[model samples]
Target: MGSSSRRNTMSDVTIIGLGPMGSTLARTLLKNGTNVTVWNRTREKAEQLIREGAEFNPEAAAAVSASPIVIVCVANYEASHNILGSHEVAKNLEGRLVVELSTGTPQDARNSETRVREQGADYLDGAILATPAQIGMPDTPIFLSGSEAAFRRSEPVLKILAGNLIYMGEAVGAASAWDLATLATTFGAMFGFFHGSRILESEGYRVDSFGSMMADISPVLGQMIKYEGEIIQTGAYENPQSSVKTCRGTADLWLKQALEAGINNEFPTFAMGLFNKAKAAGYENEELAAVMKVLR
Candidate 1:
């Protein structure tokens, strides 16, 4: 039988929340032939998914009771708790596995794990590193951290929702930590790209062309990712091979240009802070990664 056929043959999977991400996940489950029971605060949001073969339940407790695997992708930890903490839902969740894909701080994830466990449910914290469209496609990275046994038990179903799923150890907080770190890197790189694009546009250059050219630099980013590990492991930011001072000068020039362009200088300004700190610390002659110390 196909994966969808196998899923349909099984019992059921329940989902809470029907936002873009939640709806996408539900759709993927439905396509895989998994019987899905869904609940959302606003009932109207789930109507489309219901038409797509999902069973929409107005009662959160009924949804939880209908499935062995309960996936919650609400707004945050508090909202997730608000939905699941209902006495009826909590009471019916015993013996079920609850996988949370909501965005939250590491501490929040840890706390949620504890709270969910208190209600006699196994908790697994998950972080979806892709947009709605990428779910279930190859290369969609998802992080999971919690009970090893619980993860192993749900891996088969979870694989249907992630292209690249990683088990991030047993700490419920690990997935959230990875999520936060990854988001920071992604946002930082995007801000840099946006700043660069704006600067080029101000100079009458085609932003689209600049973006296409930048796309060719993906390999360079891969190298930078490797260097990040070296920086973390060796605590050696200063690359004696390529003086940090040289990098500082380039950063200063970029900052100056940003200021002159009347652009929000937050990105380069923050970068300059690290470069300036490293320069003041006498690591000017070190490699660019050496500036990471100042950043930390």
Candidate 2:
């Protein structure tokens, strides 16, 4: 039988808060043939999942208690606390696995782990790196961190949700820290790309034509990221293939071009500022990875 057809023997999962991501999680689970119980403050939000064979519980405690693993994806840690930490809910969570997937500060993740552990429940804190639309795909990265015991128990279900399930060790905040770092890069790339596109548009160039050139960046970004991992982790910024000086020259050209095009140079200028700072710190001759040291 296919995996979904044999879901009856698999561990049941409960999803709390039928927000966009939460609802997506519930639907993914149901579609893949997993027994699911879902709860949301607004009953209408979970109506679809309910109709799709997911058990809909009006009471949060009932939803949580129905499954071995209860996943909470809400506004943030505060909202999760208010819902899960309630007397009725808290009392029922003992010995269960609580997976917190809400985005929050590392401190929030740590605090939630402590509070949930105090309630006699095993906790795993997670940060989903993909959009809700990408939730069930294998290639989506999900960073999870917490006690090893808790992780071992949840691994099977996690694998079902993500192709890339990164367990960030036993520290509760590691997943959140990595999640924030990933978001920083993602947001930076977003702004940086748009800034350049705008600069081109200002020069009477078609944005559609610029897209073909933009597609060429994938390999460059991939290589840089791979090199950064090898270089930064070992603190080896020496004997450069591409020196900081060369990169700064490129960034300066970008900043100057943006300025000459009468477009906002803020994005390129900000990047140039970093390159300038790195050069000023005497890393001009070092590999471009040395810029990371200045950032530190």
Best by TM-score: 1
Task: List ranges where model 2 is wrong by over 4 Å.
Answer: 1-11
Q: lDDT (0-100) at residue 26 of candidate 1?
A: 91
Residue 241 of model 2, lDDT score: 85
Which ranges of candidate 1 are over 4 A from the true structure? 1-11, 259-264
Model 1 lDDT, residue 45, Cα: 94
Per-residue lDDT of model 1, residues 1-296, tens digit only: 22233233434788899999999999998899888888888878987887788877788988788799999998999999898888888999899999999999999988998888998999999999999988989788899999999999889888899968899999889999999999998888898899888888778899889888878998897787787677768877544555678877878888889778876777778888888888898778877777766766
Error of 1 at 231 (Å): 2.7
- Lowest summed lDDT over 10 consecutive residues: which window, candidate 2? 1-10
Per-residue lDDT of candidate 2, residues 178-273 (tens digit): 999989988887797798689778878888777777687788887878987898899888898889999888888887887677778887778888
TM, every model: 0.92, 0.88
How far off is residue 98 in model 1, in Å? 0.3
